[model samples]
Target chain A: MIGEFSPGLILILGALLVPLLRGRLRAIYMLALPVAAFAHLTTLPHGDLGIIELSGVSLTTLRVDKLSLLFSYVFLVAALICVIYSLHLRDTVQHVAALIYAGSAMGAIFAGDLVTLFIYWEAIAIASVFLIWASRTEDSYRSGMRYLIIQVGSGVLLLAGVLIHYRQTGSLAFGALGLDTPGGLLIFLAFGIKSAFPVLHAWLPDAYPRGTPTGTVFLSAFTTKVAIYALARSFAGTDILIPIGTVMAAFPIFYAVIENDLRRVLAYSLNNQLGFMVVGIGLGTDLALNGAVAHAFADILFKGLLFMSMGAVLFRVGTIKGSELGGLYKSMPWTTGFCIVGAASISAFPLFSGFVTKSMIMTAAMEEGYFWIWIVLLFASAGVFHHAGIKIPYFAFFAHDSGKRCQEAPLNMLVAMAVAAALCIGIGSFPDFFYTLLPFETGYRPYTLDHVVAQVQLLFLSALAFTLLMRTGIYPPELRSVNIDAEWFYRRAGRSLADGARMAAENGWKSVTHGIGRTISVVIAYVQRHHGPEGLLARPWPAGTMALWTTLMLGACLILFYL
Target chain B: MSAHRDPKEKRYWLDDPANVTRLVRVFYVVCAALIAIDVFVPKHGPFAIEHWFGFYGFFGFLACVALVLIAKQLRKVLMRPEDYYDR
Candidate 1:
C-alpha cells in the first residue's frame, strides 16, 4: 500500500531533479516535495506495516503511530518552510543536501526497526554536514568535519548498540529498550550525544552558526529532533534524564547569555529547550509525554523562526555577532517585528507557544515531586527569557545603533519567518486545537488562572531583572570575544595536544636523520682511511703487503683445513 | 537643512530618550501589578517554597542576578579573543 511507503522518500527522491531545472521551476519543484510528503503523511495508516523478512530476520519498514506521525507532521512542515527560506540560494549542493538531510531525519523518525533507523541515522549525518559546508569557508569546512565525526560517531554507537541488542533479544524492533543492558545504554548515549547532553554538545553551537543563512534553518529543524524522537520512543521515563535535562536546560543558558554570535546564542537556547523536552520524557506521564512532544512541535517552529530571522540578518548585514549589530529595527522593521514574535514564543510569554507547552512539563515535574528539578527548570525558564527572549531581539535590533542600514530581508525569507511566527502565536493562542494532535489523551488544560498567574509573575519579574541590570550596567555587555566551552578541549587543548605530538615527531625525525648522517659519514671516513692515497694500503708498498698478507692468510687457512 | 530635522535622516519614537524612560516606567508598573496579583491569587505547587508569597517573582529576580554575576566571573576564565580558535 502507498500508506506503507515512507513519506520522507518524497523529498529524498525529488531532490535529485532540483539541479536539472532552471530557477523558478526548481523553487516550485523543491517546495512541492515537502507539501506532497505532508499530503502523503495524512494518508498513512496507523500501526506497523507488514514485516518483510530480510535473510531470516523480519524488518518493520514503516510504523505510523501517533508518536512517529506527530514527528513527521512537524518535520514535513519544517522542511517546507526551510525550502521556502532557501529559495534565494543558487547553491545546488545546499539545496539537495538540505532536502536529503531533512528527509533522512524524517525517515529516521518513522523507522520501525533498529537497522532501518541506523541506516537513516547515518544518512542524516552524512547529508546534513553539507549544510554547514555550504558556507564554503575554511572555518565552515573545518567545523563541518568535526560535525560529521560527531554525527557519524552517534550512528556508529547506534549501529553497535543495534547489533548487540539484536544479538541479545533476537528482535530488531525499535521500541522501548530499557537501560538494563549494555546495548540499551549504548543506544542511550548515542541519542544523548545527538541530544547535546552537556559535554557532547559542542558541535551544536560550533557548527550551527556557521551554516549558510538558509541552511541553518534547515539545520536547526531536523538532526537533534530526530534524536529526541528516538529517545522518546526507546528511553522515555528514564530517571537519569531528569538530571541530564536539568543540566541541558541550565548550563546552556549561561553560555547563551555570554555568547556573541546571535545564532550561537540561539543554539545554546536550542540546547536549553531540548533540556525541557528531555525532562518531559523523563517524567513519562501522559501529560509529560504530551508536553515533550508538543514542545518539540512548537520548538521546531519557534526555533526555526528565530534561526530564519537571524539568517536574514546575516544574509543582509553579513554578521550575526550581537556586539556588531543594533538599531536594525530602522531598516528591517518587519524582520525585527517577526523576531520579537519568535522571541516571545521562546520566552514563554502568556500568549506564545512556549507557555502552553513548556509549562506542561514543569507542571508534570511539580506534580511528580521533582522539586529540585522543577526549581532548576524555573531558573532555566527565567534565564532563557533573559537571553533568548530579551537579549536576541534587543541586541540585534534595538540595543545600540551600529549604524548599519540595508534593505530588509528578501521577501521569500520574510514570508517563511512570518509563517513560522504565525504558527507560534497560533499554537500559543489556541493550544487546545494543537493539543488534539498529541499522542496521548491528557485531560490537562493550559490556561487555568493559577498557571497563568505563576507564569506571568515569573516572566515579568525576569524582565524586571533584565531592565534593572541594563539600567545599572550590570548585565554583561556583548563583546567581540569567544567563550570556550567543552569543545575547547578539541579546538584548543586537543589541537595543542596534536601540535605537541607533531612537534615531538618532527624533533624525533630530525635526530634520526642526524644520527643516520653521522653513521654514514663515519662509515665513509673508515672506508676512506683504508682506501685513500694517504692510507697504508694506498702507499707504494701496498702491492707487496697485499701479496704477503694473501699468502699468509692462504697458508693459515690451508693449515686449519689440514688440522 | 531645516532647524527641526534633516528629512534624509530617519527616526522612530524609540529613538527619543523620553520614550525609552516611559517604556521602562510602564514595564515597572506592570511588574508591580503582577506582584500585587500574586498576593491575592492562590498559587499551588508540589513544594512549600512555591506557595510562598512573591516566591516566583523574587526567585526569578535573584536567580537572574546570580546567573549574570556568576557568568561575569566565568568570563574571566572562559573568554578569549574572537580569533582565539582561528589563531
Candidate 2:
C-alpha cells in the first residue's frame, strides 16, 4: 500500500497510524514521518507527476515545481517541530488533526490540477478547525465556528469558480487565471480570505490564539501559506496585488501596535508578513517569485516558532496577555531567549532568518521600479521592528517585572523551541542555504555591507522610536481584555443589527394583532346593535341573510380585483 | 499567606514566591542552555536543517528566553482587577 501511494500520501498515512501506537513510539512516528516526507518532496524532479481523468476532464493531480516545493518544504518542517512541541500530548484527536491538516496542505501544494487542489484546499479548511476547538474553551468554540464558516465559504466559492472555469475553458490545469472574468474574481476572493487580505482577516486573530498551544503552531504554518501558494499560482503578475500588498504591509502594524494579546499581535504580524509575499507575487519576475517562495518558507518557520513560544507561555501560565506576564525570565529564561530570537528575526535583525529572506522581497520591489512601494515597505519594515521586533520581547520579557514565575516549559516544548531557534540563526548566518531553494536565479546577496548596515540603521531607529514612545507613555499598553478588530462587524455590529431587526418585526406583529383586535371589537359592536348577540355573524343565522352576505362578499372581491 | 500581616505593615514586592531566587536559577539554567544551542549549533553540521527549520529554530529559542523574562516583567504592568481593559 505504501509503495503504490506517493511519498506525500505515505507520510500522511504513516502519521495516521501514530495514534494507534502508545507513548514513545508515537513520538518517533510523528517526528520521522515529516522528515521522510521532506526527503521525498526534495527529491522529486520538477515536472508533471501524472494525470488523472475525472469526468472526462484530465486533471493534473500532482506537479512538482520550484514554487510548490518551497512551501511544501516549510509545511513539512513545521509538522516536525510541532510534533516535538506536542510530544507530551497524548490527545489522539489533536495529534491526528495536526497531521491531517499538515498533510492536506502538502497535498494541495503538490496538486497539479485545479480540481485536485480544490479538494485538498477544502480539506485544509475542514481539518484545521479542530485545532482551534482543541482549546476546549467556550470562546474558542464560538470563534472556531466562525472560522469554519468563513473557510467553508471560501471553499464553496472556489468550487463554484472551478466549475465555471471548467465550463468556460474545459480545462482543469492549475495555472494563472485572469482576474477580469467572473470565475476568476471568485477564485481571487477565495484565496484572499485564506491569505488574510485586509477585511477578510478577522478569522485569524479571532481564532488562532484560541487554539491549543501545539495546535496554534500547526495553524501558523498551513492556512496563510497555502493561500500564498494559491495566490502565487493563480494571481502572479496581477497588477492589483501590488497596491493591495502595499496597503496590507502598512495597515496591520497599526493594529499590532495596539493589540493587547501577544498572540493576536503576532497574528497581525502574520498578516504583515503575507503582505511581503503578495508583493513578490505581484512583481511576477523570476527574482520576485524566488523572493515570494523564499519568504513564505522562512515566514512559516519563524512565525511558527514565535507562536510556539507564546503558546508555551499560554500553556504554563494560563495567559498570553502582555499585561498579565513579566519577570518570568527568572523562572523561564529559555523561553525568554527564544522569544528574543523570534523577535529579532521578525524585526529582520542582522544574521537572523528574516534578515535573509525578507530583504529579497523588498529588493524585488525596488528592482522592479516600484520605488514608492519600496518606501512603504521600508516604513512597514521599521514598523515591524517596532511591534514584532521590539514590542513583543521588551514588553513581555524586559519591560517591567510582573513577578509571575512560571516553571520553564516542559522538556518537549523546550526541544521544539531549541530546534526552531537553531533554524532562525542558522539561516541568518548562512543565506546560501535558503537562497539555493529560491525559484529564481539568486544573484542577490543578502549579507552585503550596504544591506546589513541599512537594515541595522532602520531597526535601531525604530527601537529608538519605541523607547521614546514608551517613556512618554504613549505606546498602547497590553492589558487583559478584548480589543476590537474587523470581526466587530460580525461579533458586535452584525449581532446588534440582527437584534434590532428582530425587535422591530416583533413590535410590528404586535401592532398588527392589536389593530385586528380593534377591528373585531368594532364589528362586534355593529353585530350587537343589529341582533343583541356577541357578533354580527352569530346574530345573522337565517338562510336568506347568509346568502345575502355571501353575495355581498363576492361583489366586494370582484370590485377589488377590477380596481 | 499574608492574612496574618497587619494592615499597617508595609509590604515588599520581593515577598512574592514568584520573585524567589531558587526558581529563578532554574530559569537561568534553561535560558543558558538554549542560548548555547542557538549560538553554536549551525557551526556543527549534523544539526543543520533546511531553510524553514533553521529559521524557526533560531527565533523560537530567543522567543523562549523572552517569554521567561516577559513573565517577570508582566507583574509590574498587569492589573489585579479583571476589568483592566474596560477603561
Candidate 3:
C-alpha cells in the first residue's frame, strides 16, 4: 500500500505535467491533481505501514501512526486549499514546485526510516526554493538564494549526522537518539535550523513574505512542520529541549509584536508555534508527545488558513502589510470571517483547535514539575494571542479600513480558506479524531472541564490584557518599516564585511602599484644622475678606467684586511 | 490634491470621541462581564458553557468589534503604492 498508486505522490507528480497544457486546461489540470491527492490521502488506512530494511540495515520506519497520520492528513487538506487559493497563478515553476514541495512533505511523514525521511527532507528544501524565486523580483531573488542556502545547508547537516549516527549505533532509525555525542548534537542542529530555533530563524521572515501569494501558503505548511516531526522522532524526552523550546516559544513573541510586515509577523509566530511543539517533545511523555504531534497538525491547519487569507489579500490588492491593509472586511466578508476562525484557533480560544492541543504540553509541563518552564510557556501563550491570534486578523481584515477596494479573491482562494477554516473548527470541536492518531497512549482528554475552564481563563485574561494595552495606546501597531531581526546580521553586518574587504583589497592594490611605480622611478632617477653625459662616472668609465678602479679597490681591501 | 478635508478623517482612534467612546464602552462591558463570571461561576463542566460564554464568547465578540473598528481606523493608514513587497 505504501508504494501503491497513492494520490499524494500522484497529484504532485501529475502536477509536473500541468505546464504542458495551455490556458484554462492548465489551471484545471493543476487543480485536479491536489483534489486527487486529497482523495488518496483521506482514503489511506490509519495504521502503520511496514518498515523496509535497506542493505540489511533496519531503518526502523513506521507509517500511518497517529502523529504522522495527523500531519499527513492536514498537509493534504492544506495543499488542496493552497491549490485553490493559487488557481489564478500562471507560474508553472511555482505550480510544479508547490505540488512537489507539499507532496514530498507528505512523503516525509509517511517515510519508514531515517533514510527515506532524509531523502524527502532534502527534496523539500530543493523543491521549495523555486517558489520563493517565483516572485521574480530582485529582493525576492536574493531572499530566495539565502533561503536556499540555509535550507540545503540544513540538509547537509542532517546527512552528515545520519552517516555518523549510522556508524555510531549501527542503526538508521529516526527515534530517540539523545544528545549523547557530537553526531547527536549535529542532528539536533539540523532539526533546529529548520525549526527556526532562535538565531537560525532568519530564513523564515526573509523568505516566506517574499514569495508569491500562493507560494507563501505552500511555504507556511511544510518546512517548519517537517522539522517539528523530525525533532519529535529524534529528541523527544530529552530535557535539554525543554529550555530550548521555552526560549523558542517566548522570544519570537516580542519580535512579532513589533514587526511591521504582517506576513513576517506570522512567520515569527510560526517559530513561536513550533516552540510549543518542541516543549511538548522535550516533556517527552506520551501525552506531551501527543500534544506536540497534535499541535503540529493544528498549527499547519490554522497557520495555513492565516497565510491563505493573507495570500488572498495579496492576490487581490497586492499587499499584506498592516500599514497597507485595512477595511477589507467591508469588501471581503467571507474571507475576513474565515481569517477570524483561523486566528481564534491559533490563539487557543476555547472550542478552537489550539485549545485542544496546546493544553497537552502545558499539562505535561506542570505534571513534570517544570514550574518555571510552565510559567514562561503561559507567558508565551499570552504573547501568542497578542501577536498572531489577535494581531494578524485585526490588521489585515478590519483594522482602520484602508478603504481601497479590490475584487475579492477568486473562488479557489475562498474554497481554500473555507476548507482550512472548517478543519480548524472540526479539530477543536472533535479532537478524538485527531487524538486517536497520536503515537503515545493518551489517557488525557483535551475537553475535560478543568482543561476547558483553565484555557478559557488564560485566553480570556490575555484578551483582557490586549484590550487594556490597546486602550492605553501601548500595544505595538503595525508600521511601514522593517524591524531588525537576525537577518540584520547578514543584511547589515554581512554587507559591511563585504564592503570592508573590497575596500581593503582596493587599498592594498593601490599601495602595491604605487610602491612599484616609486621604485621604478627611483631607479630611473639614479640611472639618469649617474649615467647622464654630464656625469663623470657615466662619461669616463670605459674598459681601461673600470679595470684600474677594480685593481685599486682590490689592493685597498687586502691592506684593510691586514690592518 | 485638495487640502481641505473632513477633520474626522484626520483624527486617530484615540482622539476620536465616536470611535474611542464606542470602543471603551464595549471593552468595559465585555471585560467586566467575563472577569466577573470567571471569578463567580463554579469551575465545572456543562456550566462550562457559562465559562465559555464569559470568556470565549465575550472576548471573541470584543475581538470582532475591535477588528471592525480598527479596520475603520486603518483606512487612513492604508497605502497602495504598486508592488510594495518588491522594494
Question: Which of the numbered candidates is closest to the native, going by highest DockQ?
Answer: 1
Candidate 2, A305-407: lDDT as tens digits: 8898888888888888888776566667798899888888888889898888888888777667786788677777877777787777766666666756578
Compared with the true structure, all predictions reach lDDT values of 0.91, 0.77, 0.78
Interface DockQ of candidate 3? 0.10
Q: After best superposition, candidate 2 residue A290: deviation in angstroms? A: 1.2
Rank ordering of all candidates by lDDT, starting from the highest:
1, 3, 2
DockQ values for all predictions?
0.58, 0.05, 0.10
Task: Kindly give the number of clashing pairs for every candidate.
Answer: 0, 65, 17
Ranking by DockQ: 1, 3, 2
Candidate 1 per-residue lDDT, tens place, B1-87, comes to 125444578668987879999999999999898888887887656689978888888888888888899888889999999899988
TM-score of chain A of 3: 0.86
True-structure lDDT of candidate 1: 0.91
Candidate 2 CAPRI-style tier: incorrect
- B-chain TM-score, every candidate? 0.85, 0.29, 0.32
Interface RMSD of each: 2.6, 13.2, 9.7
lDDT of 3 by residue, A209-296 (tens): 9988889889999999989998887888888889989999987777676666788888988989898999999989988998998898
The prediction achieving the highest TM-score against the true structure is 1
**lDDT for each residue of candidate 1 in A175-234, tens digit (9 for 90 to 100):** 998999989999999999998999999999999999999988888899999988998999
